[model samples]
Structure formats: structure tokens, C-alpha cells
Target: MNRIQQKKDYLKQSLSLLRDKFSNIPADKSVIHKVASPLRLEHAKGIVADAILKIMNDHNLQMLALLVNSCRSEVVKILNEYSEKYFKELKWAVIDEFGSVILKLNTNIATHNYLLPPLLDDLEESSESSDFYAKSTNYFSAINQNLLKIVIYHWRLFKNATEQGYLSASELILKSNVSQASVSNFIRYSLEKNYLLKHKIHNLYKFNNNCLEDLLEDWSFYYKNNYGKAIRFISYDTTYSIDTLLLKVKVLRDHNIRIAIGGFLALELQKLNYVSDIPDIRIYTDNIKYTKDELDLIEYQSQDDVTGRKIIELVSPKAEASIFSHIMNKDIPICDIIQCYLDVRHKASRGMEQADFIKKSVLL
Candidate 1:
């Protein structure tokens, strides 16, 4: 029922599934690694897919192993596709019996020199190499919270700038609330990654105008992996509709509850509508549990229990700073263009089309 309990339940279920499948694997051949999903919900799929992709590229890791839980088929497929397309020499073993992975390195195929020291230690300590099941704990280890905030600050400046206005490094550090050392480090990293170009004008070090699209995506991905945990529920009442949900949300807002609309419903309210059916409503707040109590929402025992029912998702943005920048629409607060776009970009329901429209019509 609570966040910690839900996580414990998920880990227990996951480990039980893994043990049954790997029981026959030679003790010498199999290793078990314990991992926690970034999101609290078990049915919240693809939480680790992006992490896995980043690890493989960052560490030049090879020989991926997969344990295919019935619920994780989509994530497994994505890992398989990415590995095949990028690393032709990489190996994949999808164990159907165990819904987990064991990373058994084949020294003959994998190069010893490519194995990074820190990663090797983590693997050795865990005695597991199943990249699919293991948490990519260090995926965003190098990125700082201030770095992301600085990027977002620049993005806001770019959006409002009437002309090519460049800020000096010192000014950037002062306005973005970051340390001088962090700004220096960010300048170095951005230049190296080709995200920004530096120019010297009138003895001032200024950065060239670089589009924040890629940087924003990176920020969103990092935020999702680290902070985007949500408490979701489905209504047992079949008569409750999207319109009804909006009315209730408006009531919560009237009571001074700091709630903002997000996801599909937010997009529709912002007039960037592309999807025909509103599958669910996403609400962003600082304290979801408190808000849920205010809204009198019930937590469903299982997703299967309420098939074809209206769902409500309550997410608390745990980022150091607020990314929503929400606008009040007809007494209802809704997330900004960037937040709405990022929220629905990966959804199954025409999410790409909606995101494209926002880019062309608003962001571009």
C-alpha cells in the first residue's frame, strides 16, 4: 500500500520468479543481482530500459543476458533490438523459464581490456551480470542536479530571447544559482559533447546559440529514472468519466491544493491535442500522498482488477527544481509545453505525433 512496501513486494515477486527459472543453472554459471526499479509500481514498464542502453554504451559492456518476465516482454525486446543494431558482436541470452537475467561472461568473446574497473567491481560484488535485471545505478552518476537546472534556465532564456543574446560565463553562474566551478565544468562537458560552442567576443567568453532539444531530452530521461515515481489508481465506478475527473480536480484546486494537470489531459487542454481517446489523467503535485488523501482516491489492489476502467496517476516531481512551469487554464493548472511534451513523448497513444506537433508549432 505504501511506497516502500510496494517496492519490497515487487522485489520479492521478481526474485521468486528468477529463482524458479535459474534453479537448474549451474551454481558456477548463474549469478543473482538484486535491483530496485526506478518507479515504485511493478506494472510501470520500461523503467530500466533506458538505463541499460546507457550502461552498455558508456562502459562498452558486451555479452548481455536477459530474463523475460511476461510483464517485461516489451523492455526485453527493446534491449535485444538495440544490442543487435549497435553491437553486432554482442551476445543475448533470453531465458524463457526465469523471468530475470544472469550475466555469465564468455571470456572467449568479450575483450578483457574493455571491462571498466568500477563496473567490474559492482558485478563481482553482486555476483550477477544480467544487465536487464540489474539497476544501472551509475547511469546518471556524472550529471549534477545544477547542470540540468542550468540547461533548463538556458532553454527558458532562449525561448524568450528576441535576438541572439549571449550571457557571459559569470552571469550564467550567477543567474543559474550554480557554483563557479560547476559552470566551468559544464562548459567543458558541453563543449566536448558538441552541445554548445564557445566564442570570445569583446574579451567575454560567451556560448553560441545551441538548440536545447537534445539536452532537454537528456534531462528528462535522467529526471524520469531518478525522480519520476507515481502513485496510480483505477476507478471501480464505470460512470466516472474524464469530464467528471476534471470537475473533481478543479474542486481540489479550489481548496488550495497545489495540483497541476499533466500527460494526455494536459496536452488536450493546451490545444496540442492529437490523441482521440484520453486514456488517463496525470496530476503533478509536490506531495501526492497528501493530495490523494484530499481527493479521496482509492488504490487498486491490481491493475487487472479494473480492466477497461478510467485511471488516475498522481506524480510528485522530485527534481531539485520545478520543471512544470504550469499555466492556469480556465481555473485549472496545466503543465507547460516542455513538461507536457516530455510526459507523453513515449506513450503508446499517438505520443510521437503529438510531440512532433508541439515541436513544429510551439517549440521550433
Candidate 2:
């Protein structure tokens, strides 16, 4: 069979084993809430375990098979009309593994596909309380920058929560700007690596015992490690004096060019006690033609490696704006402290030493 069929078969087998357990599932609202809790997928496992029990006892397993395939929504609609009105109250769902998630779906994302369900329902619920999931912790990854941005937006959520040990997939979806399936994958990674714990809450997750300091340290490490693709030198030119550099800046500015001084030059312009023999004249800009033609830059074919003291032009690897609100030398506009710090972090002979000094002196 194809990959989708193979996955389907795997899901069926897992469901069949649990088919008989649902026969005596408790009907009490409290028990049902615990079993069908949308906060975490684990709680939904009870539904599947009960599904297996009910399926085995019945001769007509057609409906049960559909529910087993993650098609919970359709099953719920069908259950509503079934002769047994009690079935309407039954929360039938499937619990299986897809990527890092132990999926608990009472419904498939769609009837045509056999994949996991979307977290739209939970998303609606999240609109009611956005702060519950963000205060104590934030999710950031070296592998995904978009997800990192989403986490950054919600980082404050963790700080506000005095005791937030459980996070649901829906909260994660909204917080991370990721889809339900993506949230499941990341949760699986967090759980397996022990960053989060699968707690008592049905669909919620718990911490795996790492203390606050350790968690913060790991996040810091990931941030620095994945600050992502190093500085890119798109074009460069040789100019010997600070006066010429200022003139070039004036030219770019006169032409309505958006540019900002960065790297060691920014440090020097800031009047910080930074010592450098070959101070880099770095400028961030959207337009490269003006500088390349205006300054007569010798094209350096190598994109990964190139340097120039007179002038170097770069565009952000992620298309981030070159915000130059800070003015360092009265007339010369400079990039923000963070941008300047990164620009020289890995460049020049004494770049690291300067970066350290800049970080402690300005950024700290």
C-alpha cells in the first residue's frame, strides 16, 4: 500500500485493540469532561480505548471504523441521529501518534483525508484567554524562525502565569503561529527531549522537571546558536578615510537611500571605548546599486566570504528591515545596538573581543 494507506492501516490496528473498552465508559459529565478534554491529547486516549471496546462488541462496525480513522466530527453528527440518543452524548475519538503528537481526534481534519484534525475549536476558545499559556515559558527553535517569532510574541505569557504547568495544543497553535499538526510535532519533540511533560490534564502537557534556570539557559543557547545565517556581504568598495565614508553616507541619504552604519564602525561612532585597527564600514540598505556604482565596488564573487574596510553593503538574510533610528555621530545614522553587535560578532581579528565589549558596554 501507499504511505497514506500504510498510515491508515497502522491507525486501524491501534484502534481495533481499544474497540471494546468504550462499552462501559462513564456517562457522568465530570468523567466525560476528563475523557474528552480538549486541553491535551492524552485525555482523548480514553475515548479511543473505549472505542475499541464498543467496536468489538458490535457486529455492525462500519460507523466505528469511520470514527477510528480520525473522522470524529462526522461520527458525532451520525451519532446525533442514531436510534440510540445516548450515542449523541458519547465523545468518540481516535488516539494515535502522528509525528511528535499522540493525537486524540474525535474527528479527522477532513473526511477525504486520513490525517489529524485541526485545532480550530480550541483556537476559538483561546480567543477568550490568550494570557493563560504565555507567561511562564516560551517556545523558540533554531530550526524554525517563524515559529520563533510566534513564541517571541507570547513570551510574556509565561512570565504572567504564577503556576502554568499545562499547555494545550490549541494555545500552542495560536501562540506559535503554527497549524495544529505543526504544534503536535513540536510538542512531541518537547516531550521526548523532556522540555515538557505530559501531565494529568487530558490534552495538556507538563514540564519534564527542568528548573527555571536550566530552561532559560537552554533558550538562551538556542537563541545565540541559531541567530541564524551569518552576516552577508552583498557588495563592497575600498575607501580610505572616515570623511569619505561620511560623504558616501550623505550621497546615499541624498538619493533617498535607506542605510544604516553597523559593525565596528557603529561602535566607534557611538564614542564607545572600542579599539580596532581595521574598523569595518558596514552599511545595511535595501538598494545595492547606488553604492556599487557610486563607490565603484570590485565584485567579489564569493557570497559566503568577503570583506572591505572602506565600505561593505549587506541585506538582512531574513529580509528584516535595517532600522536606523539611533544616531551615533550626530550626522551619521547607525543601526540599533543589537544589529551592530551581530554585524561584528564574527568579523575582524578582534571582532569577538569587541562584540563582548559592546554587549557588556551597550547591549547589557
Candidate 3:
């Protein structure tokens, strides 16, 4: 049978097993909750374990099945351990039952496409402070605690950065209440992974904009022009490594003209007092160090703010000429005439109309 039929059959079998277990319990609401709660807790633990198992199986790591199998038993033992050692007032059995039901519902949805009927009812009862016994269960409590920590950390960092000028690595450590070593490791890892870039000025770090732009350009190009035919220009920034930039260029080599620029540097240059020519692009190493300039020619506007005047001048137009001269200097060889025409047309429509005329006259 097909994949759909196979999935449906598997789901049917699982649901049948679940139904049998479900029917054994009493039908009264209070009695049902009391009995099914433990089952729900166990089942939730099982679902997480199963998901882990499926991932492990896919990765050929099924040797860890022992650890996976111990999940439910370990959870139960831990609950019991806590109850016996710490608090006599804690009702872990109820927590376990509620968890099992939630887990069963989650797993059913995941594996069998079955929806839970009691979720809304449970949520309603749990919403009220008077229903603290119903709401403050271990499973939900753990999830809430972990989720809150993550959300709060992210929110606070985001707020601090936007409200304040910049957040340093040390600042992040203090704000996060994490160790300096841990923060250092995180920063190092992020830098290595190209997730963040460190500005050399004051050791300030920021999210990598070049990576984000490249991702956007890639998605846009793929969706807009699937065919490997024409030149499309993509704007990338300084955060990209030479390798990453090259890979993106190669993907679009057949049909794209990628424009590399120091996006952050460009924005920052506007604030600088120096009238020095800004390089068109800046290349960075995996270690986040500026290695060498990729492009030869650099250009910039004059310090004098002239309206609608040609205040900007190319610093190394000859260098630029040498670069493009290698590509376009020669007459289009006879064999490449047709391809050249198409290339010129594509580039022309993309605002290189002047190049189209030059190519047609020189090549034809």
C-alpha cells in the first residue's frame, strides 16, 4: 500500500490498543480523572521517550534504547524519591495521572492524528486559583518553569539591547546571571558558528545581518527564478565568510550577479567623520577577523553635502576596470554569441541596459 494507507493502518492499531485501556476505567468524571491521571502522566513520559526513540532510530543510535526505556520508571522513582525525602504533603500520584493523560493526548496527535476531548475541560478547571490542586501539577509546572526562564531571558536581552545602545558579552553574563566562562563559551560558539559578529571598536557583538540577508536572498532567488539562466543581483554583508559567500555565488553563478557590501560598516560609515573611501565589500574569517579586501575598487561621497551633485568619486576605478576587463573586455567569442546575448538581455532588464548595447555592438 501507499504511505498514507500505511500510516492510517498503524494509527488504527495504536488507537485500538488505547481504546481498550481507556474502556477499563470508570466513566464518572471524578472517578475517571482519578484513575486516568496516572495513566496520562506515564503516557506523556512515554510519548517524549518515543519521539526520542524515533529520532535515535533514524540516526542509527538505537543502542541507547535502555536509557529510553528507563524514562517512565525513572520519572516515577524520582517522584517517589521527592515525596519520601522532602514533602509529605505533595500528592505526586495525581500529578503523575494528569501528566499521563496529557502525554497520551500529545502522542496520539503525533502518531495517530487523534484529538483529546478533555483538554479544554482540564484547562478551564486549572485556570482558577481555587483549583490550585488541579493546576499546579509537576509536569505542567516543570514545563512552565523551563519555558518561563527561556522566554524571560530572551525578552530581557532583547529589551536591553533595543533600549540601551549595545550589550557586551560581559553585560550578557551579568544580565543572564550565568557564569563568565559560560557566557564566553556562548559568545565563542556563536562567533564560530557565524550566528554573531564582534565589532572591533569596543568588543561589541551583534546578530549577523549578512547571514540573515543571504538567507533571504537565497529564498527569494529560489522562489522567483528557479531556472539557471540569468544574472540576479543579491546584497550580502560583511558577516559572511569567504567560503559562505563563494558558495552562495556559485549557486547563483549561472543566473545571478551577487553584490557584496559591508552592510553594517556601510551604515556606520555614515556616522564617521573621516571622508575615506569605503571598500565595496569586506571579507571576514571564521574567527570573525577581517582578513583581506576581496574587491579592488572603493568609492565614497565627499565630506561636502552637495544636493544632486556627483560628490562621490571612485578611488580605484582602474582596479575595477581591471576586474571587469577580464570578464567583459574581450569580444564575445563566436561560439558564445547566443549565450552572451541572453546574458546581456537579462542584465539589461535588471538595469544594465547600457551594458546590453555595448555587448550587442561589440559581440555582434
Candidate 4:
């Protein structure tokens, strides 16, 4: 198909998908009708905006600028009779295509609605500490330590059951192993939190929205500001070998954070392809020798050099040395490392020791 026909087809598909997803809402009919017809005027504006985006991507910026100007002239003509609110809403669709285009035109665009006064008040009262681990622990503890585990388990079960087609209340109870009352409570909670939906016909539960994406985005922002510039204290061992460490490294990089690998894995990192892609990687191995080719095998890259910092290696005498001390000496924060260590220690002491320790810790 030609470019113009392709653009029209895409818009038709998008409108159809949106209507199908929102079939439950009564207002969706009006929304769908608006996209289907040019009576709203904004419908044509959306088409023009989409076409401009295609041209922008296919051609040079200079050519795109001219095309945008031509489209803007036509858009202004169509929007002349529309009110500011209607125009503003139409501008949102335009901004979605080319953010710079909207900004260049100097349109008064408000992307997100402002938070309610109560929410703003709560946020203001919350402490503004750069220590993410401490803040996360405090937030999770306030809710209850086991809440995350329960939520994650339910979330996984909901996803798995949905993929398999449908699930019954009995199936949910069996998979989660929670009391009937608790299951009902979690279902209500998930609905309120916009995490899960109920399929009425199938009588099954499924993820309502992309909660995982939001969770990962939240963590990414938290880690970037808190630990991106710091040297990480990794407890590497035979169990946590180079392969396992590489997975963690990829996760950190995916979140656009830079970390210097420290501990036993540092030697193993130097023996792999850590340098060719992740040249900023600094290995803190105790006199381990590696060839340049081995260093060249590491495959990782920073999203941007703006947040990148040079890596420094600190040699330690023991294999399992106090890596935290070295990190502290370097003036890098170690709250995340400390919290991780404590978490591991708690998990290891899981029987009566855990119960006794928890009681003592809480009592104190």
C-alpha cells in the first residue's frame, strides 16, 4: 500500500482496538464515533498529525519542518471554530506524534492533570531523602513485610491463569493457598489499585493494566538518582558467578544506571567481554590477570554518557573482604549494600531464629 493508505489503515486499526478494549464504558461509543467521523474536526487533525510524524521520520528535519508548517496552516483553519478546550485536546494527539512540533507552535498544552490537594499534601509531608533503599524499606514496612510477597504471588498467578484461558475461584485459592476471605480481600485490593480485572463471562481474574512496566519505571527512576554514580558492593561467589552477575548488570543497564562491579566477580568480568561494550567497567579483583581480548568480550553500553562516571578499582587482601568498607572509604553511599546484606542474613536465618530475631527487633 501507499504511504497515505498505510497511515489511514493504521488509524482505523487503532480506533478499532481502543473501542474493543473500552467496550465496558458507555462513553466509548462517542469516542469511537468521533474517530470514525470528521464531525469532531479533531478527527482530521489527528490524521494530519499522524501523517506529519511519518514524513518527519522518513525525511530530513528541514523537509519535516516545512511539512509541519503546511499541516499547521491547515490545522489552524479547521480549529478556528473550536473552543480552547477542544483545541487543547486536539493538540494532545499532535504532541503524541512530535513533541517538538507542539512546543514549536507555542500551543498551551497540559499533558497530565494536576494531583488532588490531598495527594499533594501527603507528598509534601513525606520526607525527601535521596536514600532509596531506606525510603523503600520504610514504605514497604509500613504496609507489612509480607505484603509484597503476597501481591507478587497473586500477580503471577493472575497472569498465568489468564494466559491459560480462564480460572475459577477454587483454582485461585489452590494456586495462591490463601483463605477464601483473604482471596476476596486481595481481589478487591487489586481492583482498587488498578492491577487486576474480572472477566465476567469467564469468571476469571487477569492483569488490568501494565503494572509491571510502571513498577520497573518507578524502580528505574529511584535507582538512577540514588545509585547511578556510586560504586556497587557486589557479593560475588561461585554460586553468584559471572553469568549471574551479567544478568544483574543487564538489568541495571536496561534501567539506564551505571554501576562499577566490585568483589570476586570482578576477576571473572575481566576474563569475559566486559570492555568492548562496557568500557567504563572497573573490576576490583585481587591481582587477577586477564588478556585484553577477554576484557573486550563484555557486551554492555550506557544509555547516555551524561550519567556515566569513571570506574575505580580498590584491591582487597581477602577473597571475601569487607567490600562495604571499601565503598564507604570511597565516599559512595552503602545503604543499598547494607540493606541487601541484612536481607540475605534474614533469609538465611529462616526458622525459629528468624521468628526470634524479628520479635526482638520489633520489641526494641
RMSD of each: 13.7, 17.5, 23.7, 20.1
State the lDDT of candidate 2 residue by residue for 283-329, as single tens digits: 66657666556654555457344544343555433323214433344
Reference-based lDDT, each prediction: 0.52, 0.45, 0.30, 0.32
Off by over 4 Å in 1: 1-164, 169-184, 202-213, 220-224, 241-244, 247-257, 303-309, 324-331
Taking all chains together, the TM-score of candidate 2 against the true structure is 0.37
Clashing pairs in 3: 37-97, 38-97, 40-99, 40-100, 40-101, 41-99, 41-100, 44-103, 230-255, 232-256
Best by TM-score: 1
Model 1 C-alpha RMSD vs. true structure (Å) is: 13.7
Q: Total backbone clashes of model 3?
A: 10
Candidate 4: residue 247 Cα off by (Å): 14
Per-residue lDDT of 6-92 in model 3, one digit per residue for the tens? Answer: 323333333344456454322222111111212244654443344344434454321111111112344444434543454322222
Expressed as tens digits, the lDDT of each residue in 286-347 for candidate 4 is: 32222112222222244342233322222222212222222322222221222222222222
Order candidates by lDDT, high to low: 1, 2, 4, 3
Give the TM-score ranking, best first. Answer: 1, 2, 4, 3
Query: Number of the top candidate by lDDT?
Result: 1
Candidate number with the higher TM-score (3 or 4)? 4
lDDT of 3: 0.30
TM-score of each: 0.51, 0.37, 0.17, 0.27
For candidate 4, give the lDDT of residue 123. 24
lDDT, candidate 1, 1-364, per-residue tens:
4433433334444434544544533231232222332112242223234444544665534333333322233334454465556544344333311122322234244321111111112232333433322333232333344444444446555745633344567876776565787666666545543444555443233332343444444445554555656778776477767777777778877777677898888988877787768767788876677777766667867767667677788887654234333344757778767667777776777776777787677665
Candidate 3 Cα errors over 4 Å, as ranges = 1-165, 209-364
